[model samples]
Structures are given as C-alpha cells and as structure tokens.
Target: MDTMLTDIPGMATYLDDIIVMGSTERSFMGSTERSCQVLNRVLEYGFQLREEKCIFMHSTKYIGFISDKNGRRPDHANIEAIQNMPAPTDVPSLRSFMGLTSRCSTFLPGMHQARGPLNELLSKDKPW
Candidate 1:
C-alpha cells in the first residue's frame, strides 16, 4: 500500500485508510481532489474501494478524533467508551482501567490525583 500511495502527495494512508485535511478552504479542496486522483490511480491498478469505507468531507469521527475551524477534539463515542468502561477487580485490572483513564485524561483535569487511589495499589510495597 505504501508503494501504491507513494504518488499521492497530500494524504496519510494507514493500511487502507487514507486521511487528508487542510487548514484553508483552497488547501482543503486540493486535498480532496488529490485524494480523488489517488483513488482513480488505485482503480487503474485494478483495486476497488469499498463504498462503506469511502468517506468524504463528512465524518462523525475519523481515527477517533474530529477536526474543523474549532480545531481537533476527541469524538463523543471515544469519551463514552471510557465513561462506560467497567470497574476493574485486581491490581492488573486496575492497571488496565488506569491505562484507559490516562488515554482520555486530558478531558478530566487533575486526572493524576484521580489515579492516586489506584496507583497506591500498584505500589511496590503493596502486595496483591
């Protein structure tokens, strides 16, 4: 896929997903057009794009984040995932929960303090 994408100058392709964005109106249209050209090239290579995966200017969430004039923000679905994560049981499970919290910690200020109770359990002197 890297080789296939080498000719496309204005997008980032991860596996089969191609992501493109631009800060200016003109650049944004350029990005879209460049992506279209790349897609055409891909088609010429006898590869097909899945209609479901073919997203345009609109996306509820792209790669778990969103962007626009407001700047980038975490997707609502991502926030809900952490909120809905189940309580952890043992030290390892607690660690996993802590990991999830850390991933979205920016949403909650003083997040380090929130992990204090859990971190205490992972302390070396503390036995599981």
Candidate 2:
C-alpha cells in the first residue's frame, strides 16, 4: 500500500482501496478511462481489481466518504450516527460518545475544551 502511493506515479491507495485522481482537464469519460488504465496496470502486475469495490467518477465513494473537486467530508451515514447519539445522561453514555468522537477529534474544533465538561461526568462518585 505504501509503495503504491510513494513509489508509483498517478496512483493513491487508502488501505486496500485505490483512488486515481483525475487530471486538470477533467470529465466523466476521462476519469473513467484513467481508472480503467490504472486498473489494467494493477491487474497486469497480478493484483485483481474488485469491480464492486471500485469507483470511477468524481462523485463516487472513497474511503467511506464522497469526494469531489469542492472538498471531502463525512457522508450522510456518519452524520446520521452523530445526530442519533443518545443524550449523555450519565457517565457511561458520555464515555461511549467520547470514545467515538476521540477517533476524529483532531478534525474537530474546540474538542479539547468541550471535553472538559464531559470529563467531569466520569468522576468517581458519578453514577455509571
């Protein structure tokens, strides 16, 4: 995976998945062609292309997120999970939410400060 990105030109890998970013002169057909070319090369080298796992357009899913020229961000399913979180009525629930948020806390604004209040919920005498 590391070699696929660092050693190869025009190829990028995220874990087992691959992304072939299009050139400046972008079009759906051009991107699809580029994807096919890359996939062919990959297969020629004995790596199999998982068609079901491949995406070939700007709007296609990548790394569990949809990306385009505009920018990349979390998809609706991730947003829905955040929206549906139960209110942290106690320490255990707060801790669970903290664990989930901690995974992406580096991307979160005011995460350290916001965690101050949440951390208080985990005090020894607090109800679990």
Candidate 3:
C-alpha cells in the first residue's frame, strides 16, 4: 500500500484507512486532485473504498487531533477531559495527568517551562 501511494504527496494510510491532507490553499487543491488519483489507483489495484467513509473538503479528525489548513488542534473532547481532570494530589496521579498532556504537547507552548514544577515532583529525591 505504501508503494501504491508513495508518489502522492500528503497521502497517508494506516491499516486500510487512508487520509489526504494539505496545509495551505494551494496544496489543498492539489490534495483534492491527488485524492482522485488515489481513487483511480485503488481501482487499478482491485481495492474497494467505502463511499460512506469517504469525506472531502473538510477538516477531519485523525489520531487524537483535528487538522485543517490552519494546522492541527487537540480534539475538543480530549481537551475537555483534560480540563475536567481533578488536580493531581500524588506522584502517580500527576504522572497520569502529565502523560495525557504530553500527548498534546505539540499544541502547547512553553510546555517544558509549564511542567517544570510538576516534573520536579516526579524526581526520586523529591519525596511524595
């Protein structure tokens, strides 16, 4: 499958799902065209695509984030979960919160600085 789509920019496949993306208006048009090329290639290779699962010209959720030309943001549901999380009262709980936050770190600015104090608590010598 990788070899099949390798020639198309901004195309990615995982298992059987394929996602096409473009980061700007210029590339978005190209992305649309490339999707057609993908469809033709799928036919050429005797693979079938479910039309119901296919989406076009819209920001779509992939992995844990939603992305568009403006770039990716953490999914709102994920953000809400993190926001509603109770403040961590112990090392283990803090670690849990940090782990979740780390998954969205790309959307967070100054993450290292923001987490400095919490990270200190995780140190062996810090004492619970």
lDDT of each: 0.70, 0.65, 0.82
User: What would the per-residue lDDT of candidate 1 be over residues 17-112, giving only the tens digit for each residue?
Assistant: 666556665775675678578778788777777888766573335666776645567788878878797877687788877876676677678997
Most accurate candidate by TM-score = 3
Native-referenced Cα lDDT, model 1: 0.70
* Candidate 1 vs 3: which has more TM-score: 3
Q: TM-score rank, highest first?
A: 3, 2, 1
Q: Give Cα distance to truth, residue 122, candidate 1, Å.
A: 1.7
Model 2 accuracy (lDDT, Cα): 0.65
In angstroms, give how far residue 55 of model 1 lies from its true place.
8.9
Q: Pull out the clashing pairs in model 1.
A: none
Candidate 1's C-alpha runs over 4 A off are 1-23, 26-60, 125-128
Pick by lDDT: 2 or 3, better one:
3
TM-score of 3: 0.60
Compared to the true structure, candidate 1 yields what TM-score? Answer: 0.49
